[model samples]
Target: MIVGLTGGIGSGKTTVLNFFKAFQNISVYIADEEAKNLMNSSPLLKSQLINAFGKELFVDNTLQRAYLSNLVFKDPKKLQILNEIVHPQVAKHFSEFVALNAHKAYILYENAILFETQNNQFCDCILTVSAPLEDRISRIIHRDQTTRRAVLDRMQHQFPEEKKRLQSNYLIQNTSLPALKEEVYRIHNILTL
Candidate 1:
């Protein structure tokens, strides 16, 4: 089973992936992290990013993430364009990851935009993690060292939690760690059985 794991920024999707990893019965493929790696490693992606964001955005074959983020967050159109440039590649790599892990009882393909990009088509089921909006904003502000407005700006480009909640086959409320772990384990048993 391939479970599409997703949540908004600061919603702790990665943390939830860790909890799922405890089962030792699944493999994880984090799309955003893979996209970053592709941005640095893939010549085609590097050229496209340079064309879209400017050549100065990369240094020593690595993306200057902060600089690129500033431009994209300021303009919704720019963010959409960047996503357009990267998502297809990420989706392609995600498919390969699934194929390699085909023997696993379950695999977790974690991406923040699973539903938005219609990547859910690749999933056997979808799990959406969520928390209160203020909590999400605060978490992102602390983790990204950005202002509330900036976090809100990025959130603006994402699908709303309520809508994701409706779409998910399973939902993790994510108010606390124990509950989150318990839910993950429960789902693991369900999937494995």
Candidate 2:
């Protein structure tokens, strides 16, 4: 089963992913991390990004992540263009991952933009994690060392939390670690069974 896991920035999706990792029956794939790896490693992807953004996308042959983040967060078109450049490669890679993990009872594909990218179509079921807006803002500001304005800019590009909640098969309202873990375990049992 391909289980799509997604949430907005700073919603603790990574923490929930960790809890799911404790279950031996589940295999996990994190799309955003893989996208970064692809951007850094693939020469073809590198050229495409440079064409869309600029030569300064890389410095000393390494992706200038901070540069790209600042650029895309401020412009919706740039963000979409970046996604268009990266998502196809990630999707292809994810298909290979799914094939290798076909024996697993559940394949948890974690992506922040699953719904935004319409990747949910590939999922057997979708799980959306959510938190209060202020909590989310605070978490991202701390984790990314970014300002509230920047976080809000990125949030605007994502599908609305309310809409995601309505569409998802399961919802995790993340408020505390203990509660989050309990929910993850409960959902894991349900999926595996």
Compare the candidates by TM-score and give the number of the best one. Answer: 2
**TM-score per model over all chains:** 0.96, 0.97
Tens digits of per-residue lDDT for model 1, 59-167: 8888999999899878878988998999999888987888898889888989898888888888889999988888899998998888999898888878998999898
Worst 10 residues of 2 by lDDT: 71-80
lDDT of 2 by residue, 124-146 (tens): 99999999999999999999888
TM-score, prediction 1: 0.96
Q: Cα lDDT of model 1 overall? A: 0.89
Error of 1 at 174 (Å): 0.9
